[model samples]
Target: MDHDESPVLDALAEYHDRGYLDFAPPGHKQGLGADDAVRRVLGPEVFHSDVLATGALDDRRSSNRVLERAQELMADAVGAQQAFFSTCGSSLSVKSAMMAVAAPGETMLVGRDAHKSVIAGLTLTGIQPVWVRPRWDRELHLAHPPSPEAYDEAFAEHPEAVGALVTSPSPYGTCSDLKSIARVCHDHGKPLIVDEAWGAHLPFHDDLPTWAMDADADVCVVSVHKMGAGFEQGSVFHLQGDLIDPVRLKQSADLLSTTSPNVLLYAAMDGWRRQMVRDGRELLGSALRLAHAVRASIDELPGLRVIEKQLVAKEASHDLDRLQIMIDTLDAGISGYQAADWLREERAVNVGLSDHRRILAQLTFADTPERTDRLVSALGDLTRTSLPAPSSVVLPEPRDLELEQVMLPREAFFAAQETVPVEEAADRIAAEQVTPYPPGIPVILPGERISAGVIDYLRSGKTATMVIPDAADPSLKSIRVVADT
Candidate 1:
């Protein structure tokens, strides 16, 4: 219960003090065996901190209670009844959360705009998805988290659903009305799991989008690496109330989580929690002000519309994360993709989460006036000497993109399947997911009856240089489908 005690850091410090040398799993034993080239690039400190969580940080039996105590402090920091750290990031944490409440073949209400990882969860577990459609802002051609009414309709149809999951503060900075959605879920005795991966900094700042824990989400997964000061892949999921059993959640995480957990990640998580508790509010306050200024400045540029309060318009999202600077490049005669490529290649400014319509700049407490000024200057320069715009990327409309569920995802994924060229695989039931990265929503989730329109869009997307890492081709040229047996 002591907020000041960081068990993970304490144990790590103890291990170092005791001169705990290991001949264990990590071939790079305390940087002694690390290649000089590797140490030069990654630094010896990284290898030194990569000690075994149990064998090195604590003892074999873990009598020190290092992880357990660290989790408790994290829970306290976020006002959650329980918290579990995951080195594998929120992607794994969210899957574990889904399986904890719902089992194979059980129905779970899910937002259709979820990350590709959620679709992966569906394919892995046999959970039947009851899709809750996101509030699509057709004008912006962007997807926001589903409104409460959308989830209400979904629950009305599948009242027997075990739980609901919503991705609030969607990658584009749009947020759902989680408080109302939570009330809706609680009224039906269903737990609400918020994929709040980009919301780790929310709790500390009042002006930011409401944190899931504060909004009454029963289970909230957050990536400490996002909007927080931590190493990449640092993630934690917090839970409160009787809707979800914390013990079951921990057990579920343990089943999917890695056995050789990273002590460096745990220490970073500990350090981040302490930093946030001590100075997050002040740091975030400055970042918010800088974001507002930057957004206003970006708006003055030709053909650049900074999607800010424009997102909060009742016609769009219910709420918005102000720090998310979404710049629409369509008016500039360039696709968001083109603008992103040009900016990065020309000015060395990389925007986060680019889509056909917009490039999103994810501002964090780490952002400063200097960095934002650089971004604004780059954009200003980009539009001035622009090359010919990219050919129009034919994006599928909200309806055209939606696929018909022909079979269960698990069956289609695991059942007899054949590989065919993507061009010829249209109209066949998709046996694998073909999703565009960046927003990472699958265009072709397994078991869905693929449409020609969707295929054309994805194929065209690939031609335009869309990153589809999960696909067999990454170019969406080949497709996997249930074979005619």
Candidate 2:
């Protein structure tokens, strides 16, 4: 395999060189029909490369195998048996991976701290999830990926489970011991699916946490856009071993994928693979060094603490990606929401993943000294500014946060539902997802019996600027619940 070869990118270049005319569905036809204002804002190159993946980028029959070769190159780059591109992002890829191992009505062991997308897969497919509890740090108010023992216990209890899924490098960059978890799954003769959406760069650098494929995971889905240099919504599924059928995985993805895929997204991922193969180590090594410096500098700031030792402690996460600089703002006397809002509105600096007490600065290989300097300066300014104290959110104990599932997610989501006031919603089964964005983990999932502690948490968190975007009522004044039979 020639690591330098970029099939999708080369085909795109050839398409431009051949001067192919399109009477395609895009209707823009290389920006000719696009509005001048739109073209001016987005640039002509964006529309020019927006060609159809089938008839335009490759032949109608796809005899050239441009996309196929690109996928092969990506798999080789990451040391996986096979790779499938997804223009729909890792959310769709993860769902496809889930469906590959477990069919509707079958059981799968899933970490409770999974992203809302995983829960969405449960609702769309009738998969019964045996929830695995993540290692909760009650004092830090954080949830690490569930340990291998947890999965082993789950499989022992529910031997009927077809497979398992775990999320690594959680939004805050805490990682699970994937090798152990994968071994646990294989010991039970079940495949392991890793939602490694935040770990696209893990393969390119050794100092970083272990890549899912390297850890012997049967199936791994990564969002190239998150930690790699690719267009947004660009994702890939890496599959290895005979535990999961490659044909079935592809078919599962095809079921949820769009017929008219974006050639631009394909080309970007192809180019990124080539770039990473050639220069990823150098780029990521530099990034790791910069991240260390930035972490030290941020930690030096008054009233700010960089969370590293605690995250990778014996009882917490097995590993940590230092690139994600999670700063505890509790000592700063303002909430993460306030710091995030102030930083964006005042300094034009946007940190990713803000929570009740912490703000995360996600540093990727693309970051430079200048960019990080600006972040540090803005954060320093934030500490010095006199801001009104944020209202205290009624944080729930770890046990209270774990609501009991009363019915299947699909059943509760589609069943006759009624909206009730928040005060009256306790003890009722939830008919919808109420999630705080940034991390996007659903605090209240459908079919889960809502608790007063959860209600108080949501209500108070909402008052303190938490954004619950998925709730039927974002205001939190009312909640959607399953109606009485």
Candidate 3:
């Protein structure tokens, strides 16, 4: 398989070159019938590239095997036994990996600091989750990836567990000791899955933290859109070793995937794989240098601290992806939310993730010196500007933050439920996930016993500009809890 040959992209080019008119499901009919305003904003090319994966991109029978060939090229480029593309993003891909490793009623080891998507996977699969505690920074009020010993403890407590799943380069860019964790899992004859959505560029650069494949993970899910040049929602899950059945992984994905796949996303992913194989090292090398310079510059700015050293200690994370420039904004006399809003509204610059006291500006190979300079100037102006900090969130202790699980997430979530005031919601089993978006980690997952402290934290954070998009009641005035039988 030639890594240079982007089959999906080539086929898409041919589809346009041959001028094949489609009477297919996309009622827009190649942007001709699309709304004038939509066409003007989205451009006609997006719709033109929006063709059926099998019928248009390949043939009616998919005789060309364009997608398969593209996937093969991706696998070869990444040094994986197999690679599967997902148009639905790594949210679906990670869930598919989880389901393939552990079935309903079985147990899987999962880090407590997992993204909301991983919690959703637990809810969707009915797999019992043996929670491994993440390394909590008490002073910083942040959680890093759990250590290999945490997984070892979890497996010891639940020897029946089928496998383990960990999130590397957490939205904050802190990485777990994947190699040691993979060794721990493999020693138990179980597979290891890495939810590495923030690490699509990791494999391309050796200086970056070890990606899942090189660390010997059985399966790893990546979102190309996050760190690569692919369009949003483009994701790929790579497989290696014989621990996980490739057929089972495909079946799991098919169960949750769409029947009508997006060819545009497929083509972008195919093109990106070729790009990475050819020039990823040089491109990422440039990004790493830019990130270091930016971090140093940001550190020099009064009242803004770039967090790098504290993020990679033996007690914290095993490694760090420097591209994710996490800044402590509390020193700037304004909350991260205020800083983020100001940057967007005033300077037209948008930071990636923000919290009560921190803001992140994600750097990628696509970012240039001009872009980073704009970010620096905006942030420098932000430090000089007079903006009052928002009210603080009363963060709970690490132990209090760990809610006890009484029922399986699926059962408690789908059971009889009722909406109750925040005060009365305490001690009740939660029927929904309440996450702080951007970093998107669920503070309270379904089936967990909701605590008054956590509730107060959510309500206070919301009042202080925290956004919880998945909650039934984002305001925290009320919460949905499993009804008593």
Best by TM-score: 2
Give the CA lDDT, 0 to 100, for residue 388 in model 3: 68
lDDT of 3 by residue, 1-485 (tens): 67768899899889889999888768889998999999999999999988888788888898898888899988888889899999999999999999999989999999988888999898888999989988779878899888998899889989999999999989999999999999999999999999999998888889999989999999999999999988999999999999999999999999999999898899889999899999999999999999999999999999999999999976999999999999998777788899999999999999999999999999999999999999999999998898865888889877778999998999988899999998898899999989989888999988999998898888889988999999998787899999987
Query: How would you encode candidate 2's per-residue C-alpha lDDT over 303-376 as one tens digit per residue?
Result: 88999999998889999998999999999999999999999999999999898899999999899999999999
Candidate 1 collision pairs = none
- Give the backbone clash total of model 1: 0
Task: Give TM-scores for every candidate, taking all chains together and pairing residue i with residue i.
Answer: 0.97, 0.99, 0.99
Cα RMSD to native, each candidate? 1.4, 0.7, 1.0
Query: Candidate 1: where is the Cα deviation over 4 Å?
Result: none
Report backbone clashes per prediction: 0, 0, 0
State candidate 1's TM-score.
Answer: 0.97
Candidate order, lDDT descending:
2, 3, 1
Candidate 2, superposed: residue stretches over 4 Å from native = none
Better of 1 and 2 by TM-score: 2
Ten contiguous residues with the weakest lDDT in model 3: 388-397
- The lDDT for every candidate, in the order shown, is 0.87, 0.94, 0.92
Q: Candidate 2 at 60: error in angstroms?
A: 1.0
